[model samples]
Every structure is written in C-alpha cells, then in structure tokens.
Target: MSNLAARLRARRAHTRTRRAVSKAIDTATTTTMRDELITLAQTHGYQKSKPRV
Candidate 1:
C-alpha cells in the first residue's frame, strides 16, 4: 500500500513537470521567433535561399 501511494505521488509530480515543460516550449516558439530562426538558418546555409530579384 505504501509503495503504491509513493508511486502515485511520483506520477503526479512527473505529470506536473511535463506540463510545465510543454507549456514553456509552446510559449518559447512564437511565429516571430520561428521567422528569425528561418532567417538564421538561411544565413547559416541550413535553409535554401529564395532567388533574389
């Protein structure tokens, strides 16, 4: 019984931690940041460049 209770408590804590991490990741990757990343990638040659006029 005690071991089962301990496992439940651990699972709750793990769930809370996973939720926080996922929320953080969602907030960190905004559209502007994504665009900046794309530009950065192009500069670094990781993304293909569009043909300039």
Candidate 2:
C-alpha cells in the first residue's frame, strides 16, 4: 500500500513538471512567432520605422 502511494505521488509530480515544461515551451513559441511577424512587417515596410528619441 505504501509503495502504491509513493508511486502515485511520483506520478503526480512528474505530470506537474511535464505541464510546466509544456507551458514554457508554448510561451516561448508564441513570443518567437510574434517577434518574427514584427520583423516581417518591418522588413516589408508594412510597419513604419520609429524615430530615435
């Protein structure tokens, strides 16, 4: 019984870790995609260049 409980706890922890990793990857992907779109727009002159302050 104790062994089963330990296994369950370990499984839950592993699941949580996997979820955290997946979320991080998703966020990074979104950020990179946004950056790429912005770059594309700038390169194509769809977005105007900002003046230096």
Candidate 3:
C-alpha cells in the first residue's frame, strides 16, 4: 500500500511539472509569434487602429 501511494505521488508530481512546462512553452510560442506579426506589420507600414467603443 505504501509503495502504491508513493508511485501515485510521484506520478502526480511529474504530471504537474509537465503541465507547467507545457504552459510555459505555449506562452513563449505565442509571444514569439505575436512579436513576429508585429514586426511584419511594421515592415508593411501597417498601423494599429483604435477600437471603437
């Protein structure tokens, strides 16, 4: 019983760590893509339009 509990705990910890790493990677990818888009737009002389209320 103790061994099973230990295994479960380790698996949970690994899952949590994997999720955190995946989230971080996703965020970094999004940021990089956004930066690239902004650069491309700037190169094309695209201006940001104001949002209409």
Candidate 4:
C-alpha cells in the first residue's frame, strides 16, 4: 500500500539520520576522551610523552 511504503521510507530516513549523527558524535567524543586518557597517563608517569620537535 502507498501509505505503508511511505511510512517505511520515513522510518528508514530517520534511522539513517540517527546513525549518522551518532557516528559523528562518537568520533568526536572518542577522540577527545582518548587524548585525555593519554595525557592523564603521561602526567601520572604511567606513560611517557613523546618529544615534539
């Protein structure tokens, strides 16, 4: 039915948008979190900081 098809399309669109948004947020947050963890370790002498030339 046309109505069913329309509903399916809308649902798919919503799912795709949600997935894309979550993926974007995940990348940004994970990047900062990883950086923070590495810095924290270095500060506590658990990890050494690489010298920047």
Candidate 5:
C-alpha cells in the first residue's frame, strides 16, 4: 500500500512539473515572437540594409 501511494504521488508530481514546463515554454515562445514582430516593425524605413551575420 505504501509503495503504491508513493508511486501515485510521484506520478502526480511529474505531471505537474511537465505542465509547468509546457506553460513556461509557451510563454517564452510567445514573448520571442512578439519581440521579433516589434523589432521588424521598428526597422521599417526608407533606407535600410539587411543585417548580415
């Protein structure tokens, strides 16, 4: 009984951790996209050369 309970607790904790990571990844992706869009918007000008690495 104790072992089964421990396994269940561990599974639940793992699920919660995965969910948190997924949310964090989604947030980071959205922020990055927003920043890129803003940067692109700011670069709209009459004379501008493409940035080369």
Candidate 6:
C-alpha cells in the first residue's frame, strides 16, 4: 500500500512538472512569434491599426 501511494505521488509530481514545462514552452514560442511579427511589420512600414467595434 505504501509503495503504491508513493508511486502515485511521484506520478502526480511528474505530471505537474511536465505541464508546467509545456506551458512555459508555449508561452515562449508565442512571445517569440509576436516579436518577429512586430519586427516584420515595422520593416514593411506597417503600423498597428485599431480594431473596429
């Protein structure tokens, strides 16, 4: 019983860590893409337009 409980705890911790790492990677990728897009728009003399309601 104790061994099973330990295994379960370890698995949960591993899952949590994996999820955090995945989220961090996703956030970094999004930020990098956004920066690249802004740079590209600036190079092409494009300004951000306001959204219409």
Taking every candidate in turn, the Cα RMSD to the unseen true structure, in Å, is 13.7, 15.8, 14.5, 14.7, 16.0, 14.4
Model 1 ranges with Cα > 4 A deviation: 29-53
Give the per-residue lDDT of model 6 (tens digit) for 21-50: 444444655778757656655565443444
lDDT of each residue in 1-53, candidate 2, tens digit only? 99999999998876676555444444655778756655655564445334469
Please give the lDDT score for candidate 1: 0.61
Better of 2 and 5 by TM-score: 5
**What are the models' TM-scores?**
0.52, 0.53, 0.53, 0.52, 0.54, 0.53
Per-residue lDDT of 2 in model 1 = 100
13, model 1: CA deviation in Å?
0.5
Return the top candidate by lDDT. 6
Candidate 5 off by > 4 Å: 29-53
Candidate 3, residues 1-53, lDDT tens digits: the string is 99999999998876676555444444655778756655654565443334469
lDDT of all the models against the reference?
A: 0.61, 0.60, 0.60, 0.60, 0.56, 0.61
Q: What tens-digit string does per-residue lDDT give for candidate 4 at 1-53?
A: 99999999998876676555444444655778757755655564445323469
The backbone clash count of each candidate, in order, is 0, 0, 0, 0, 0, 0
The whole-model C-alpha lDDT of candidate 6 against the native structure comes to 0.61
Off by over 4 Å in 2: 29-53
lDDT of 3 at 11: 82
Off by over 4 Å in 4: 29-53
Put down candidate 5 lDDT per residue, 1-53, tens digits, no spaces: 99999999998876676555444444655778746544554454212234469
